[model samples]
Target: MSDDCIFCKIIAGQIPAKIEYQDDDILVFHDITPQAPLHLLIIPKKHITNLNEIRTENADIISKIFTQIPKLAFQFEISEKGYRVVNNCGKDGGQTVFHLHFHMLGGRHLEWPPG
Candidate 1:
């Protein structure tokens, strides 16, 4: 894990986060600055820099994240209401943290062409 990465620090117990779920390969937590009523982040334990760095070998880890999204949405009381999962890529994509993560947002109407 990169020492400078915040998500890595969170995963290592070096930084505090409102964790929602955790397993051997992944961790889910609440967003510090929430955009929606239920804004959460799903992250992998491995220190991947971004989505471009994901490899075929990481399929299982990625798949597990997808499989848990619905459950997490339900837990956050947003499943029946619907939700959106997002991944910001690079600087232009508005990614502040380099570590790969997915943002789960719900509990409000999402408009088209998100900024």
Candidate 2:
């Protein structure tokens, strides 16, 4: 893990977060700054930077994150209506944090063409 990465700290238990789920590979937590009623971040335990850095070999790991998304949304009672899964790839993509994370947003109407 990167020594200065915030999400790394959270995963290592060096920092505190409202964690919702965790396993050998990923950690799920409520976003400190929630955009939707059920806004959460599903991050990898290893520091991956962003989607642009993902390698083909990481397909299974990426699938694990996607598979867990609905399970997590179901726990929050937002799975039936639908939810949005977002992964910002770079600075221009609105990625504030360098860590690779999937934003799970739901529990209300989400606007199309997110700004």
Candidate 3:
């Protein structure tokens, strides 16, 4: 884990987050700043810098994260109306945090051609 990464701190229990779901490989939590009525941040407990950093060895963890998203969507009652899964790449992609993470957005009509 990166010494200065905020997500790492959260995963290591150095910080407090409104955790939603957690397993050996992943952690799901409510976004501190919600863009939708249902906004969840799904991340892997193992630190990954970003999407570009994903490699073969770590691919399974990424897959596990996807496998959990739908379940979380259902748990948060957003699956029926559908939801958006987003992963911002870099600074240009609006990824303020360097850790690899996905944002699950639902509970409202998310506009097409998002910013």
Q: What lDDT score goes with residue 94 in model 3?
A: 94
Candidates 2 and 3 compared: the better one by lDDT is 3
Task: Write the residue-wise lDDT of candidate 2 on 1-115 in tens digits.
Answer: 9999999999999999999999999999999999999889999898999987789877567989988987887888887899999988888999999999999999899999899
Q: lDDT per prediction?
A: 0.92, 0.91, 0.92
Kindly report the root-mean-square deviation of model 3 from the true structure over all alpha carbons. 0.8
Off by over 4 Å in 2: none
Clashing pairs in 1: none
**What's the true lDDT of residue 21 in model 3?**
91
TM-score of each: 0.96, 0.95, 0.96
Q: What tens digits encode model 3's per-residue C-alpha lDDT throughout 2-110?
A: 8899999999999999999999999999899999998999999888889998889889988899999988888888889999999999999999999999999999999
**Alpha-carbon error at 101 in model 1, in Å?**
0.3
TM-score between candidate 3 and the true structure: 0.96
What's the distance in Å from true for residue 106, model 3? 0.7
Q: 87, model 3: CA deviation in Å?
A: 0.2
